[model samples]
Target chain A: MSTKRDKVIVCRCEDVTLHQVDEAIARGHRDLESLKRYTGFGTGFCQGKQCVALCARLLVERGGDPPTKPITPRPPIRPIALADLARLVDDGDGP
Target chain B: MTEELTQPFDAIPDACDVLVVGAGIMGLATAYNLARMGAGRIVIVDRSYLCSGASGRNGGGVRAQFSSETNIELMKRSLELCDDFATEMGINVWLRRDGYLFLARNAKRRAELEASVALQRSHGLPTRMIGPSEILSIVPEIDVSGIEAGSYNPDDAVVFPWPFVWGYARACQRLGVTVHPFVDAELEATGGAMSGALLRSQRVESLGQEKHIRAPLVILATGAWSPEVAAPLGLELPNHPHRHEICSTEPLKPFLGPLVADLESGLYFSQSMRGEIVGGVSNARVPPGVDQRSSLRFLGLYAKALTRTMPILGSVRVLRQWAGCYDLTPDGSPIIGRVDSLEGLILLCGFMGHGFMIAPIIGLLTARYLLKNEERELFHRWSLGRFERGELLPESMILG
Candidate 1:
C-alpha cells in the first residue's frame, strides 16, 4: 500500500506526491539532495522530518545504491514559537 | 561511448581554461556568461548538488530599494535581467513583481527609509515613502498600529528560487560548459597563485582516488563555505557564515501582494505563486559558522513578528521551517573582483544574504572583466583589500 503512487505523500509538508519522487528518480536524480532539489520533497516546513527515509527507500528501489552518506539536514529541526525567539534577545543570546 | 558519457567522474575534464568552484546561482551564472562570451574550456564543480547552497534556500526576494548607491545600481540591472530571464533562458522563474513594502516602527527607522527612498527616486527607481494608511492599502492584512512610515517599490519582485538556478545550469550546459556535481575541490596554489585543483569524487567510496584539474584561472563563488575552501591554501578571508532561518506556512487564498518587511524586527515574508507564506526573521544570537541548523527560537520569533506586523498570519499553520547560511562580511557588502594576493584567483562571495538578487549583474560583469579586461568602478569599490584599508562600503538596508 505504501508503494502505491497516489496514496503515498512522501513529503507531507510540501505535499510532494510519490509519483513526483518516481519521476525525479527517472530523470537521474537518484540521490536524496538532487531529489529534494528537483521535486521539492525534503525542503518543506518540517525540513525532511517525515520524508528523508521514504526518499532513501525510493532511491534504492529505482536501481540506485543506498546513499552512503546522509543528506545533511538544515537546522531548526523542530518548530518553535516566535515568543521564544524574542526571549533569546532578552537573555542576550541573540545572533 | 554512452556508458562513458554517463559515468560521473569520467565527465570531468583533466584541465580547463577557467575552473569555477560552487554550483550555486553565482557559479552557474558566471559560467553561463563566460560560455556566452566564447570563453574557452570552462568547468564548474560543486561538492553538493546545484542550488543546495543559499541559492536554493533563500526567500527569493528581489528589490531595488537599497540604501547604498552601488547596491541600488547593481540591483536595477539585476532586476532587468530577472524580468527577461524566462524569455531569454527558456524557463519561467515565476517573477511576480507585486512590489516590496518596508515598514518602519520609529522615527529613526522612518528617517532611514525616507533617505533611502529619496536616493532610490533620484536613481530612477519607482520607490517612494508611504504613510501607515498607504501601507494598509498595499497590504490590507497588515497591522500598522506601531508603524511610523513605510517605503514601497512596485518594481521589486519575488521569484521561484529553484528554477533560477536550474535555468542558468541548463543554459550553461547548452553552451558546452561542463558541470560536475558531488566533487570536492582543493585549491593547488603556489607562491600566491592558483595552479590547479585536486578533485575528489564524493559519490563513491574510493578511499584514495583523486583527480587533478590544472587551470590558470579559478573563480571562488563558494558563498558561505568560501573561508573554509580558501583556508587550505593559507588564504585568510574575513567573511563568516551566519545562519538565517525561514518558515513556510500552508498555502492559503492569496491576500498579500507585496513582500512586507519590518525594518526593526528583521522580519520579511512573501506569498509564493502557489500561495505559501515564505519568510523568516533574523536572530541576534546565531553564532558565526557553517551551522545551517534551524532553531525553535527562530520559529517562535518569526511567529510573534509575523503576528505583530500582520495579525492575519496568526491563524496560518507553519508547515515547515529550515535554515541557510548567509555569507556575511564585516562591511555588509560583498567581496568581489580579483584577489591581488592570489594571482589567477577571483573572489565573488560575501553577499550577506542578497546574493541571489544581485548575482545576474555580477555574473555578467565578472565574465566581461575576465574575458575582455573590462573593469567597472563597482568592482574596485568591493575589492578584498578594502577591508585592510578600512574603506568599508556598509549597506544599511539588509534583511533576512
Candidate 2:
C-alpha cells in the first residue's frame, strides 16, 4: 500500500500519484509550476480550475515562495454547452 | 455573473445581422469589435463557455518577435491594444511585456537565429542576434554553459488570458452585442450560401422550450475544435488541437527578467510580475490529440529540460502545473478570412499556438473583413484555402 502522502492524486483525471511528484521534486523540481510540468499535476478536463489554487497552496507548504501577485486567470470558468452560449443576447436576461 | 432569464427577447425571438460561433478569444473579440463598429444586431455563440478551448488553456505569451512577417505585424498591432487593454476594456489584465529571449545552443540553431533576426530586422521589429557573451549581459542569472547564440526582443511580452477575454466580453456587452454562454451552435444553411445558425441545448425556463438564433453572417472562431464545428458545413479547415502543458513556480525574489526559450531543450521560462517563474517547454513527443488529461511522463520530461536549461531554478518550489490546447495548422499560421463558396460565413480559426498574442488585432481585422468585405493584405495571405493552393507559411519559432 502507498503511504498517506503517496496515495494523494495530484492529477485527478489522470490519476497521477503524489509519490510521482515527490520523485520528480527530488530530481530538482521543488515548486508547483515546474512540478506541474514534471508531474502533470493539474492539466485536466477542468483545466486546473479545480486544482490550481490547491496546488499553489501545497507548493507554499512545501517551502515554495509566495507569489507577489495572484495566479493568472484564463477564460471559460465553466464549460457551458455550445448551444447555450449562443443565446446570450436574445435570452431576455440582459438589462 | 448575471442570471439568464432576465435577458431581452420576443423581438422575432431569433435572428440577427451576424452570428459568431465559438466563444473563444477570437469569437468574443470579433463580436465586441463588430458591436463597437455600430454594426447591426450581432449574436455570438459558442460550443462551450468562453475559453473552453485554446484561449483559456494557452500559456498567454504575448510576443511580437514572430518569424513570419505577417504574424509579427499582427502581433505588433495587437500588443499595442494589449498595452492599453485594461483601460480600454475597463478590466484589469496583467499585461506584461517582459520580452522574449530565444537561446541557441548549436551552430545550426545560431545560424537559424541569425536568419530570423535578419527577417525581423527587415520588418522593422526590434530584434537582434546576440552571442553567449551578450546573453549573459541581459539575463545574468541564466546558465549559458552550452548556449552559444541568442535572440532578444524586448518588445515581446505576456499577459493574463482570462481578463483579456472578460474585457472583450464586457466591452461587447456594453456595445449592445449579445453574448451567450453554454449555447451549442449548429450551422443552419440555405441554398449554396450560408444563412443562419440554430443554437441548441438552451436551458432557459422562460423560453418554454429550446431557443433558436438565426443570423445573416455566421463567423466560426472556434479554435482547436473548429474542424468539428465546420465539418458538417463542408468547410474543411486544417486546424487541429494539440495539448501544450505549462506550469508555475512558487513565488520568488524576482530573478528572471525576460522570457527565455532554450532552442536546445525547447524549454522556456519567464518571471511573472507576481514574481512566480512561469513557463513550459516543447514536447515534440506528446501524442497529437484533444485529450487534456495530464500525465506523469510529461512531468519527467519537463524536469529534465528545466534542470538542463537553467540550473538556478533547482531550489525553487512549484506552485502549480496545467495543460492547454493549441489549434495547430499545417504551417504554424492561422487561417483568417471568408470561407470558400460560403458567402457571409467567415473563418478566424487555425492560429496554431499564437492566437492569444494576436487576439486584439485579429478581432479588428476579421471584423473589418466581415463588415466591409475589405480584406487587409496582411491576413489575406493566411486564408483557409492557402493549404490546398500550396501556400504554407512556415514559422520556425513554434514551441511544443
Error of 2 at B343 (Å): 1.6
- The CA lDDT at B290 in model 2 is 74
Where is model 1 chain B poorest over a 10-residue stretch in terms of lDDT? B1-10
Among incorrect, acceptable, medium and high, the docking class of model 2 is incorrect
Candidate 2 lDDT over residue span B308-358, tens digit each: 566666666554566877888888888888667787778888787888878
User: What are the lDDT scores of the predictions, listed in order?
Assistant: 0.84, 0.70
Model 2: residues >4 Å from true position, as ranges? Answer: A1-95, B1-13, B202-209
TM-score of each: 0.91, 0.77
Model 2, residue B223: distance off in Å is 0.4
RMSD of 1: 3.4
> Cα RMSD to native, each candidate?
3.4, 13.8
* B162-199: candidate 1 lDDT, tens digit per residue: 88987888788778887777789999888788898999
Candidate of highest TM-score: 1
Superposed Cα deviation of residue B294, candidate 1 (Å) = 1.1
